[model samples]
Every structure is written in C-alpha cells, then in structure tokens.
Target: MADGGKVVCVTGASGYIASWIVKLLLQRGYTVRATVRDPLDAKKTEHLLALEGAKERLKLFKADLMDEGSFEQAIQGCEAVFHTASPVTFTVTDYQVELIDPAVKGTLNVLGTCTKVSSVKRVVMTSSMAAVLFPVTPLGPDYLVDESCFSDPNVCSDKKLWYVVSKTLAEDEAWRFAKENGIDLVVINPGLVLGPLLQPSLNFSVSLIADLIKDKNDTVNKNSRLVDVRDVALAHIKAYETPSANGRYIIEGPIVTINDIEKIVHEFFPELNLVDKNEASEIIPVIYKLSVEKAKSLGIEFTPTEATLRDTILSLKEKCLV
Candidate 1:
C-alpha cells in the first residue's frame, strides 16, 4: 500500500482521458500512482511511459476492477483519486459484460478502496453527459441540459442503449456510495469529448472525430457540442485541488452542427475541401446540450469558440488523421 503526502492516483492512466489527467498532475509536481489492468502490457502503455513525468514522478501499477483488492495499492494514502477507467464500446453485443459490469464494478472497487485510504480527501469521477440524457428522456428541440437532468437507460430505445444505461447506473451508484460513506466526490459530465489525445490509437470515441473528418459520418446529429480534451483535463485538475468543490459539473465547450467540424477543419486543411450539399441541411438532429456554468464557476475557463475548433482541427492534423 502506498503512503505519501499529496500523492494522486489515476485509474486507467493510459487511456485517452486518464492519460491527460496524469500528464496534468505530473506537470504540477504531484506524485502519481497510475493503474492499468496489466502493467506488463508494453504496447498499450508505452506512450505513457514516454510522457514527461512518467519516469520520476509517476509509478505504474496493476489493478483490476473485477478484483476486490486490486485498486487498494493505487489509492493508498493519496490525497485525490481520479476514477476514469471503464468499458465504453459502441458495438458491444452484451450489455451485461461490456458496459454494466465493468462500469458499476470498477466504480465500486475504486471508491470502496477510497474508503480504506486514510489520506484521501476527494474523488473526481469521469462521468459523461450520457448520465444526464439518454434512454430516460428524449431531449426536446429547445432543451438546454444542466445538472438537473439525468438519463434513464431502462427507457432508451436504441441498439447502443447499454452504454447510456451503464453510465447512468454507475454514476448513481457513486452518489449512493458517497452518501453512505461520507466521502467528498465530484463528477465531470462533458458532452462528446474531442481534442488532443495523450494515447490516441483510434479508440472508439477518438475514432469518431477521425471518422467525421474523413467525410464519412452521414447520419446527422445537428447540435454536436465538442469539448476539447485539454479543457476536460483542466476541469478535472481544477476540481481535484478545490477542497470545497462538490457534486456534479458539466464541461461543455460550444454548440455547433456536425458540419461545423468539417467546415472549421476544411478551412485550415483546404486540401480535403470538405463541404456538404445545401440540400440535406436539415438532416442533422439535435441530441442534448450541456451547461458549463457550474464548471466555469470553479475557475475552469474555456477556449474561445474559434480557437477551440481551430486547435481541435490542428491536433487532429498533427496526428495526420485528416
């Protein structure tokens, strides 16, 4: 078990989100205990090791969400824990194994271990906007989502309904556990995360942005709000250090149609000349809009809308994805 002052632990530390969380923490002079399911998976976590802080300030450890004692070492004596590890698959055949079990169980294990660690003061859980609107309520034409809305997976009628259901249940269980344990917790619910990835190998969500740039996504979602990965990481950093911060925070960037993504990038990378015919302009359907007031209240400033789009496009280009 680790015992240190102001040490932080990040689960799934090599993942797209958690990797950035670790990067932010290490840059701030915090010792980190980064957990992966298998520390020996060199191919999976090699890029993480090359990050600026991984060698001296970061310690790689093995933890399994399915195992009770696995997360204990990572959480031991840490001041903050970021629980970002979970299964998110758009094409999982079994909801029980793919979404429900890992998300719910991983949260339980991490927070359960949080209870045992004497030094832990806060837990920043990486929840999604899906927890707010899915299966449960169909977002209205003029709906602007805030902390008050919550998705009910049981009510959703879709092939990928399990992803929404698992996130909602897991987040609900987090609050239930927090209330029962008297531990302070904060949740970050961002709408459709985008931006630079620390370990981008074409994961399910990251690949969505890649697909959009290729002019491949035809099924329209009108109101697509993309939050920069840097902004989401910054939000977590702000929440983790704020002793009095509690409850849920939405990390939304801006409201734009799907075409905005193509247009913004195409202007910079004119080689592709990405554009849509004006005929199908009304095809994009709005899903949900998340409020960023609470997160802004915590000193999390967002990038200007123009810069947000430009930076996202540049980051995607740096990866040679477009």
Candidate 2:
C-alpha cells in the first residue's frame, strides 16, 4: 500500500494498457474509478476485478465514448483522469464515422467532463506514436523523431491511414483544448505496445506478434518501434504524479523488424513455428530514431525488447491465444 486516500479515474479500464494502469493504481493504494461500456460484462470487467488490490480499491462505472456527459460520474471527485479510451482499428469502411469521430469526439467528451469537475487536477491521455511518426517531410536515418514532431494529417488522409490520422487529430485537439481551457494535460505517445495482456482479449499490437508467430506466410517488411505495455502504463502514472511533467512524451524502446521478433520467439519458444526469414519480403530500409529522454526524465526505464517479447509470448500462451 503506497497511499490510501488518493482517488483517480481511468477510461477504457478494460483495455490492454488501461487495465494495467488500473491494476497499478490499485497496488499503489489509490482508489480507482474505472469506466467501461458495461460493468456487468464478465469478459471485460472480470479480469479487472481479479487484480490484486481491486477488491478494496477498484470501482467500475458504465461509460461510453460516444455519449456526451457519460464520463461525469466516473470523473467526478477524481484527482486525475487517465483518458485511454479511443477507437483503435486498422480497417474501416468509413474513416470519419468509424475511427476519426469516435477518437476525436470521445476525447473531447472526456475532457469536457473533466472541465466541469472541480477535483480533476490533471489529465493523462494515451496518444499513439502514430501521431508523432508520420511527418509531412521525408527524413533519412540521420533524422531523430521526438515529441516535437507531429504527423501530417494531410498525408495520413491521402494514404488512407485512418488510425494514424485519428490519433494525430485527437492529440492535436487535446493540446489546443488544454491550452484554451487551462487544463493540465499530459500526453504519452507510445510506440507499438507489446507485453502481457491483463485483458482476456488480444489487442492489436500483441496480435501483430501472434500473427508473426502463427502465420508462416507473414513477411518481415517494415520496421517498428516497440514499447512494453507495462512501461506505457507506468509512464502515465509518473506523468500525473510529477508536477513538472508537461507536454507530450514519446514512450518507446528499441526499433525492431519482424525478423527480429521471429528470432526472439524462436529463441524463447523452440516449439513454436514462426515466419521464415529466408522467405521474408524485401525489408523497408526506412527507420525512425525516437528520442525518449523526456519520458526517461520522469523515471521510466524502458523494458528490454527481449523481456517484453518473452513476457508477451508467455502471456499469450497462458491465455491459450498463441
């Protein structure tokens, strides 16, 4: 038990990252108000309730991202708000309706409720590296991507990268709203988050690794910046607790390729059949060097890639998902 009196709210409490945030907050002796679509849904709420300190410290509230004023009950009397609920999908029939609207509007709805509540002191939002990596100008290996970088909305739109565009626009809108409304907001732009899943269902990031392991035809093409899901959760808490923490923090570990992932999985689990390196497609030469000095300053020592991948595989196996 760290401190017993502090109370905070976490949106999307059933999510891969948010569930860890809720678990950690409870372990630290903070009273947690976790929001989910349906509190009665065992699949979503059961795992959260089973956390070590959940019985004494966790409370679930029903909230929807699309519904305005839905978060008022959850955020009321909370000291800090962790806004982690946003639509995440790579495929969408209507980008505006499916991805962009839910992400951008849901963010504003949460922020709007925060503005009404007097106890809300700070808001920690989970923005993705997708928001920071896709800049308009092309860069070479010499260029380093940092928190200062912004993904070009026009480019994302043109490429039909709706997920990237959604994250970028939502984060941009968050900064603008925080500035205008005087809300103390801190955003964490995390890389491809991979680690053990607290939630029962497989998330998008972990599925990428699972796909590589299970699908023999999967090819190693583009490079990816990976970060442990636990590290991302810890970063959010640190950002809120540290008074000096401000602006966006790029939370990422080493940049790796699919072949790198396949090798690691083979090293850890020899029985598992993974993608063949020889049959892999032409690897994309492009790479993004992320500057995480700001996030480290908040006392976040990133988890090693091997440990992250190992834990991820173990978790998936435990859940019988791999």
lDDT by residue for model 1 (1-322), tens: 2224358999998887888888878778789999998889886688788888678888889998888879998888788999999887867777788789899988998999999898998999999987887634468767878887878766743535788778888999999999999889999998777667666476666576567677676543455666777788878888987767889998886666666666776788688755563555555655555577889988987866667677666776787766
Error of 2 at 91 (Å): 1.1
- Computed on alpha carbons, the lDDT of every model, listed in order, comes to 0.79, 0.89
lDDT of 2 by residue, 157-183 (tens): 998889999999999999888899999
User: All candidates: CA RMSD in angstroms?
Assistant: 3.1, 1.6
Pairs clashing within candidate 2: none
- Candidate 1: residue 202 Cα off by (Å): 1.9
Misplaced by over 4 Å in model 1 are: 1-5, 135-137, 141-144, 157-160, 219-221, 273-280, 283-290
Candidate 2: where is the Cα deviation over 4 Å? 216-220, 279-286
